[model samples]
Target: MPVGLSMRLISLLIVFLLLLPSTEMKRPGKGKGLKGARQNLAPGRVRVAGRHSRSRSSRLVRLPNCSESTESGEVFVDCQDQRLTSIPASQMWLKEPKHLLLARNRIRVLNDMAFRGYESLTSLDLQQNQISLVEEGAFQGLTSLTTLLLQHNRLVTLSEEALIPMPSLRYLRLYDNPWNCFCPLDSLIRTIQVPSNRKLGNHARCAEPITLKGIKLKQVDPELLCKESDPTGDPMEDQRDSTNTLKPSPIRSKPDAIAACHTYFFPQMRMDCRKQGLTEVPTGIPEDIVHIDLSHNSISHLKARDFQGARSLRTLNISNNNMEHIDTGSLAGLLHLRELDLSDNSLLFIQYGVLEDLYFLSQLNLGGNPWMCNYSIHYMVYWLRLHPAVRHSGLLCHSPLEHNGESVEEYVNSYNRECPKDRQHSQIDQDTDPELWQTVMEVQREVEEELEPSHLKAPQKYQIIRLS
Candidate 1:
């Protein structure tokens, strides 16, 4: 009605009409999120719309700009050996990327929608990183993704929802992760059954529940994994072992019995020289043994001679031993070794060539040892870089100066001081020694002294009656 108000209204209407065209535009082609993008359909390809980022300083490594017209090829996105803390949100541009490589970085978090636009991504390699917390929805948009490589990272818990998507995902590699022993991890272990159930039969079990206590997770009742009040309410009840039966045992350690009969049951018999007071390696490991656990022993030094008989050993765990240093010669015997866990020992040093013979070795664990972590130790990091095939897991801070209060990732990337200045040789600290075999022997001796000689006598043989 008024002249000035009519002019202002006309100007506003013009601006609104101009904005309508931009909003009505159709969704652009894959990989190109910009306003104007030409559609070109092709396998393993998509094009980025915005300016291609060329900055080397961005922590997030991005795949090459794929176009809708491109063909199948390995989409290289190697930001592996960098100091990244998380997968950047900007990586959503690769809508149809085939391969995404982010190995050997310092990534600690994997947030929700981390791969928002990667709907057609097939293979993802996140081999070696410091990923500790992978929040739910970390892989929200990956639908066609098949192969996922998360072999070596500091993942304590894996939320079930984190992997509920991607039904096409197979060949999941989570071999060398330091998984926390808790109820939250039940879903992950159960998921493994879907892949390896027919092969493992009904005997496969989780090896550890508490970190060092070595309680078999399988032996613990399924009810234990659940909160006493809300077990069935949880969906993981289907994964619980249904066979609640136990094998019958004939012997019982009773005072009235003349002799005590002990029976040991293992998935497979192996050289378990733990606290046995044996100076030499045991001789009776089964030929088909796949996992060998020799932890918590007084093994002062290990040589190739010790493993001469083990040919099928794949997973060798020699943690909490008295090893000061290891040579290439010592590990040359384990040609088939895939996972070598030598944590919590007195290993002050490791020669450059120590792991040279292990070509098939996929995982190496050397955490909790007293490493110098100074300039001289730079070669260790460099060596890790050289062997891309061998998964580095998370780097452990063996010294307080390098990682007193920092995380395992912080020590590996930036805080590693690399073998401190040359100093005089210091005697090994007694507190750090892993020689607990003598203590075990002493305890056995005391038990013997407390028993009467009559108790040591043999028990009368019982008649065997086989039930039909």
Candidate 2:
């Protein structure tokens, strides 16, 4: 070999030796690296790694401040006072929680799936929250829920379907909330009033309609509370007419049937006072009488205290009589009254709220009466329209030549179409007689004064005033 070639090879060898340490350092170690690679390549090890990652992610997404525990195979969650505006999504993972305490929170509207996951929940305490507007089916999954404390919440109305899912619910605390006592609440009231059901808390009272202030929810008359008048005109204007010269017919001689007033005890206690020529409601009627028939009589007026003695009266018949006026409170005490017959009478006007106290009145016969077609009759029309259960057949209009013989429903529709703007004021044009118009205006002013808060004096004595 030549001397230069030997020197170049020696330099190459030195360079190779210099890179040897770095190459070995860059390569993976024999034991640790190979073992790790083998383990990662295995299917079981890969699944374990993926599961660990998922477990770590799930643990990180825990509900803040919500604590849960198991006792006797039942889970109990305590998320109370968490300042939660809604139910935490993490709660959906709870398995058959038996008790859930979410009281003293800031929860507002309870959506339909608010408590969806808690199907086995037996007790739920939602008191002292800002909850309002519980959507239908909010408690859909709470089939096992028995105790529900909804007191001290902002709930205004709850529909019948809202509680249909919780068949096991026995104890319910509903109090300290503003409740609107109206027709929609009738079924709820009936449900809560059941003897076996939980008692409605004392704070459950009317929160609207100044007239019904402080009235207890249990004591509220569902029928009377549901009666609503027209929002536009006075309901009493319909009966005002030019017949101010007509007077109520005087009572004639009593019929011999008065001596044979039959009393029944079967099915229900009832008194038959029909065709006895009764000038007025007969006295000495038993307080336990459930029904009374005084049809075909000469009774001209129904005084305020006429039915005061028959508080238990369920049905009253005064048809085919000379009835001209019915004073307010005349049927006040008939709380359970279901049917009333005032058909074929000479009624010109029906005082507003006169039948308001007949809370359970299901059937009313105003047929064959001389109903005046004006703004005053708006209340009756509105009431009849609102309550389809009210039997109002044959309610014909007797005045206004254009609407005469027309049903009250047809007359109302015509009135709304023709005199939509100023029907109340049009009464003056309907009656050209200034005297009659003046009388109506004076009567209207008197009624307004009577309705004033300051003028709420004792009811005046019943008077036999002429309706001419």
Candidate 3:
């Protein structure tokens, strides 16, 4: 009887032990479900690293609290397309994100210390926003930043000392800003004249004086301010008459006469007329000219006839000359041309839609010319970005913004300042009409030539007169 009772007790004990193993297995599954529910409640936590430990194949480590403070060099913040208005200040607490993109948002102002405390940040993108103002010291603490993009904004003026703290900053973009062409923007204009630097604009003319339109800042003569129409006589008055008579005026020169050169040269033309001091665009470039180089000359203006007959022309270079403007009708026939260069000259303004006809053009050289960072310059910036195939070489900004005061390349990049519209409109002289205003700017530029800081000496006899 005792042995039977013992066996029955032992059987009961074995049954309970077996049930315990099954219950333990069931608890793990139940815990998993609860954990999954918690994860659903905190989606941002799932985005953190290590939550996807099940996927051993994925190497991307989730960052701990994207907005939380981190120990340097541990994470990345991809806030692109998030429709953000301002970058959350908590980002400064992140442990050195390698890349931070804040593109496509409504960010308007970038305050000082906007990106403070993150020492290991390398790349930052603030492109495609409505950013209009950038306070001084905005980019102060980003020492490791290499590439900074701020394209497509409404910047009008940049102080000289704005970008002094960004020593590691390499690529800076302030394109597509409505730069106000005025005295306030002169420093920014001078900043873009450095090497590896580029800008997108036609010219930086004086917006205050009617006579300074289309005149590049490099060509501006502060002395012209003293040359207000002399009571005795104007020195440039006779120079103007001489210059006009030398050219078969744009209106007087027949389109056919210009086309005559096109017929003689036929499909392939190579005319050597360099250093001739020629004062006008050569007539009759062949309709199918493959290459036409008229460099190192004294040509002062560009007319519609310049490229009228060149239907199949591929390359045209007009460098090292004095040109004040790029008319809309000029170079209208370059349908198949791939390369065009206009460098080292005096260009005051690049009118809107002037290069609208260049469809297949791939390479465009416009360096060694003054590029003003003003509102009137936005047209060129927008156009260049629209056509990716077209390459701009030797482009430099002559503005002196305090942020990028020493660097020239930073001028073309995205920034929060630009030149003004009054610099292009609202003529600086007494004449209010557009035509007369244009004339005043032109004449004033010449009057101020004596004030230019070049090796060429100005005539000492000329009395002081203000061009404005």
Candidate 4:
């Protein structure tokens, strides 16, 4: 009777075993598959080589202050001011971030491989950091970078090769650093002067060599930086020996003076001494000369008595000279002088009151001078503003990065004279109407011509004849 019951139970067990699921079915959701393993792990967990499993929170977590976004299969990172002392190597995971902002941090030095593989980076901001040294090739792979901001850092100098990789870089901010303007900085100065380097203000200023401090790198004469070989003779002995041999010689005869300079007696005694390579003003010129063209020479200084005999001189062309200093009273006796051309000179400083006596001065050209546009040049700005007829367009500032490429008029207008504690006076009033000054100058010329000799005055087409 039990044989049938045992046989039915065996059949039920076999059916139950057949209905149970196989091991392959359990493997899908049991943390064996890739998706299952990922889901089983906790959020922000990462497995690093040769280290125990750790959560990202254990390390410096990049907060929302730093952000990332995926666009066009590339990630862009913004990690600005996250108190980051060094750039995270994890950025390599991005392959090549298109935009990175690491500015306003405490990054003291950038290693050579800082951006080794970030070739797709188009913009980078490292401004307002403590980056004193950027190792060569630090930005080697940033071929697509168009903008870089490194302003307000401690960088004293950078090799030309550091920027060679960034051929596409169009904008750079490198001001507000203590730049030593020695020979190494000449290349950078020339680079900034390139027209394509737009918005980069004048080259950095020199902070060393007390004599050159506060001077723009572009303004320093290249010859001043040259290292001359030691002279074979004792400098003092050579000077004394030469002085002993020098004796007062007789003055040049009148014929010799005229022969030295190309002169003309006709057309109101015009003297064309231009391009003669003369270092000093020629002596023994006729007193009746009205125009003296001594331009394009190598004159470096002008004494007060240079033109004492040329009191009747109405025009003096001294352009393209190397004149650095002119005595205060150099132009005093030229009462009739109306036009004076002193353009294209290497003048660094012009003594005050040098132009005070030129009351009838109508035209003055002071362009192409490496003017030190600082507090000391306040008087010159004030004078130019007072007389708008002066050619102010060509008066570009060569110093003070903030005022680079700015005209003298624009600089004077924007300059804050009150910024200097020692400044005694406030900014001069620049509201003088240029048109009104032009009218006054025209009237003054008419009055001066009436006082001149009839032969010196312009010929009139008609004359007034009165018979009584």
Show model 4 residue runs off by greater than 4 Å: 1-65, 70-75, 90-95, 200-203, 218-468
TM-score for each predicted model, relative to the true structure: 0.35, 0.37, 0.33, 0.37
Candidate 2 lDDT over residue span 95-150, tens digit each: 54678878779987888878865777788878779887888778887888887777
lDDT of 1 by residue, 331-443 (tens): 66668889999888787556677776677888988777777655545556656655778876535556657454343544555632342212211333446545564454445
Residue 200 of model 1 has an lDDT of 17
lDDT of 3 by residue, 1-468 (tens): 699999999999999998997788688555465445555554343222243235533222222333432234346566666667777543333244666767667889988888765556776778678888888788787778766666556776665566667667665665445655445665656654444444312133333333343344334433333333556555333223333433333364432222212111211344444565566776655454577766787777787656777677777788898777777778786778788889888763477877878899999888777766655665676577678778887655655454223223344444322433356445365647877776766665553352344567555674546577
lDDT tens readout by residue for model 4, 69-173: 776665667677787788665433434577777767889999987985576778787866899898877888788988777766787777667788889988676
Query: Mind sharing the TM-score for model 3?
Result: 0.33
Clashes of 3: 74
Candidate order (TM-score): 2, 4, 1, 3
| Candidate 2 global lDDT | 0.69
Candidate 2 segments whose C-alpha is farther than 4 A from its true place = 1-62, 70-73, 90-95, 200-203, 230-468
How do all the candidates rank in terms of lDDT, highest first? 2, 4, 3, 1
What is the Cα-based TM-score of model 1? 0.35
lDDT value, residue 426 of candidate 3: 54
Residue 30 error for model 1, in Å?
A: 34
Q: What's the C-alpha lDDT at position 103 in model 2?
A: 74
Candidate 1, RMSD to the unseen true structure: 22.4
